[model samples]
Target: MPEAHEDNRPLIERIAADIRKKIMSGDWEPGRKAPTNDELQRLYGTTNVTIQKALRILKAERFLEGRAGVGVYVRNERPQTITPAHYIEPAAAGQSYRWLTEASKRQQRGKYRMLEVAEVTPPVEVARAMRLEAGGTAVLRSRIGFLNDQPAELVHSYYPIELARGTRLADRRLIPGGSPALLEEMGYPTRSQDDEVAARPATTEEYVALELPGDVPILEIFRVVYSDDERPIEVTVIAKPAHRFKMGYHIELP
Candidate 1:
C-alpha cells in the first residue's frame, strides 16, 4: 500500500501506479508474492474495493497474476528483444536455423511450425510490396514461431512463384539455413531491408494463433528484403504479441 495522491486522480489509479513503480523498480521480484489485499488496504488506507481495483489494473498489464487459493504474485514476463541486425546478417549454410539464431544467442529456445506452403493470389498489399500484378500467384510460406514453448509470432512470407518454383521455399519442411541463405545461393542475395511497424488490436486469427491475452495488442511488421539491384525479393508480414517482444535499434549518426 502507498499514500493516496493529493490530486483528484482516482484513488485506485494512484494505488496502482505506486505498485507498478515498485514492480518496475525491482522492489518486487518476479514470482514473489505481492502485498496481500488486506495489507494493501491498510497501506493505502482505502476500502477493499479500491485495493482490488488496483490489483486488477496490474494484473491486466501482465505485471501481476492472482492464484486461486494462493495470493497474487508478480508475473515472470520476459520480453525478447528484436533488432535489425538479426535480419541483416544471413546465417551460414549448414548452421542452426537462421530465423531463430538471435533468440538462441539470448539463451532462449526458438522453434517454428510451417503451417502451409502454397501458390496463391497474393494479398493486395503483398502484391504491391512484391511488385506483383493483380491476381498474380505467389508462393506463400506461413509459419508460427514459438519461444520457450509459448506461441510468439505469426509470419507469412510471399515470394514470386516463378522465383520460388522448385525451391525449398515452396517445400513444406523448414529450410535448413533459412530463405535468406537460399536466396543468396540463387544469386538474389539480400542487400537491404525495409520494415514498417504498427501497433493495433489483435485479430481473431492472430489472438488465437499467438494465444495472447484479450487486452493485449499485437505488433505488426511488414518487411521487404531487396536484392543488390533494389528489386524486392521477398515480403514477409509478421505479427507478434506486444507484451512478448521489445524492438530495438542502433543507428550510427553521420
Candidate 2:
C-alpha cells in the first residue's frame, strides 16, 4: 500500500480494485480458488481485518463466493460471446426486432422498455457522426433491453430530424420492426455500419437505471449506419456490463 497521502482511496477499495483487476485481466480465472487470507495479507502488507473487508467487497459484487470450509473461489459468471454480424440487417416486414430474434437463438428470452422518444440536441460525438450542425437536434430513442427479465443493456439511437420528423422514429410507441426496417422503407436502406467499442466506468444514470450489481466497467458502443453514397442516417450508442459480454468479431486479411 502506498502512503495514505499518495493513494487516498480507502484500503478496502484499493485492495478490492486490485483483486478485481486480476480477475478481469484473466490472471485469476473463474472457478479458481482465491489466495488464502494469510497469503493475501502478506501480499498486500495489510492486516487480516483489511483483507476480510476487501474480500467481502468482492463477494458482494459477485466476483467471489465463500464455501463451507472449502475457502473462497472465483464465481463462474464469465462474459458470454455475442457476434455483431448476427444482428446487422433489418428485420423483414411483419417480423420482430432483430435483436430479439438473435437473443432467442441464444436461448435467452428478450425484451425491452422504451424509455423516451423526443427531439434533443445530441452529444458532440453523435452530432459529428451524423454531420449535424452545432446546436442541432435529432430524434432520440432510448430503451433498456432485458434478457430473461433482467436488465442487460441500455440503448440510445438518434436519427436525423430531417428524416425522422414525420416518421415512427420520432414516435413514442415501439416500432414494429425496429428503426432499420422503417429506414429501409423510407429509402435509407442500411448499406454499411461502423462501430467504435470501448470500456469505462458507468455514469451515475447508468448505474441506477441498469441496477448495476457493482462498479464493473461498462462496454460502450458508438455505432453509425450509412445508406447509399455513404450518407449517415442513424447513430446508436449501447452500454452494457462489460464483464457480462464478450463481443466477437471476424476480420478478413487480404
What lDDT tens digits, residue by residue, belong to model 2 across residues 33-121? 99999999999999999999999988877789999889999987666776777777999989988999988888989988999999999
What does the lDDT read for residue 239 in candidate 2? 91
Each candidate structure's TM-score, on Cα atoms with residue i matched to residue i, is 0.82, 0.84
- Number of the predicted model whose TM-score against the real structure is largest: 2
> What would the TM-score be for candidate 1 when compared with the true structure?
0.82
Model 1: how far is 147 from its true place, Å? Answer: 1.2
Please provide the root mean square deviation of candidate 2 (C-alpha atoms, Å).
3.8
Off by over 4 Å in 1: 1-29, 32-47, 50-54, 57-62, 67-70
lDDT measured at residue 214 in model 1 versus the true structure, 0 to 100: 42
| lDDT agreement with native, every candidate | 0.85, 0.90
**What are the RMSDs of all candidates, in order?**
5.3, 3.8
lDDT of 1 by residue, 96-191 (tens): 666688778778799999899999998899999988877889999999999888898999999988899999988999987788888888989988
